[model samples]
Each structure stands twice: as structure tokens, then as C-alpha cells.
Target: MAPNKDNLFGSKKEASLVKSNQLDSTVKEILASEQMNRERKTARLRELRLEKEALQPPPEPKAKAKRKTTKAQE
Candidate 1:
């Protein structure tokens, strides 16, 4: 039987395609996990800030000071 050149070369291409697909999936999963972690951290920080604000008293408003006017001619 004659050797099939198509099968011989096709196997290499198939292997590379499979490897690239796996890498793509892995990269996607990593990105998704990082995004989730960032969102979770942001939510936690927001919650902490709210809790801190709730524990603190509201700041008193400052009164405006009157400026002294000096009369030079009038």
C-alpha cells in the first residue's frame, strides 16, 4: 500500500489546532476568574466603606466668617 501524505501532514495540523484551542480556553478561564476577583474586591471595599461611614457621625457645617472692610476715603 502507498503511504498517504495527507494523513501524515494533517495530523500535525490537527495537533496544533487542538493545542491552540486548549490554550485559548485556559486564557479565557483565567481572565474570567480575575474579573470575578476584581468585582468581589470592589464590592467588599464598598461594603467596608459603608460600614465605616455608618459608624461615624456626620460632620458639622462650618460657619462663614465676616470680612472686615477698611475705609480709605469713604
Candidate 2:
């Protein structure tokens, strides 16, 4: 009989650990990609807004009306 017989439960545990590690790495990668995508979208929106503003003409200044002064009677 061989003294170093492979245990089934030990192999299963090792496989489970490997799978968990892979899942964790995959989750991290997905989250990082999502963050990058959000940043890119935000930058694109900001650029569009700036471009639109540049294309529009500036608003004209409003003219102020002169008010008549009234004399107070003593």
C-alpha cells in the first residue's frame, strides 16, 4: 500500500480555492473596466457640452432703465 494516497476531499478543497481565486480576479477586472468606461463616458459628455457652448453665441447684456427721483414734502 502506498503511504501517499491522494485524498479526494483535499483535492476538492484545492479546486474550490482555485475557483474562488479566479472568480475574485474576474470580478475585480470587471469592476475596473466598468470604472474606466464610466470615466470615459463622463469625459465625452463634458467635451460635448463644451463644444455646444462654444458653438452658441453669447447672451446680450440687458440695458438698465433709469428711475425718476421723487421729492419728499415736509
TM-score for each candidate, following the candidate numbering: 0.71, 0.62
TM-score of 1: 0.71
Mind giving the per-residue lDDT tens digits that candidate 1 earns over 1-74? 56697665667778899999999999999999999999999999999999999999999999999999988996
Any residue pairs clashing in model 2, and if so which? none
Global lDDT of each candidate = 0.93, 0.90
Clashes of each: 0, 0
Model 2 poorest 10 in a row by lDDT? 1-10
Off by over 4 Å in 2: 1-10, 60-74
Q: How do the residues 1-74 of candidate 2 rate in per-residue lDDT, one tens digit apiece?
A: 44453453457678899999999999999999999999999999999999999999998999998999999999
Which 10 residues in a row give candidate 1 its minimum summed lDDT? 1-10
**Residue 37 C-alpha lDDT in model 2:** 100
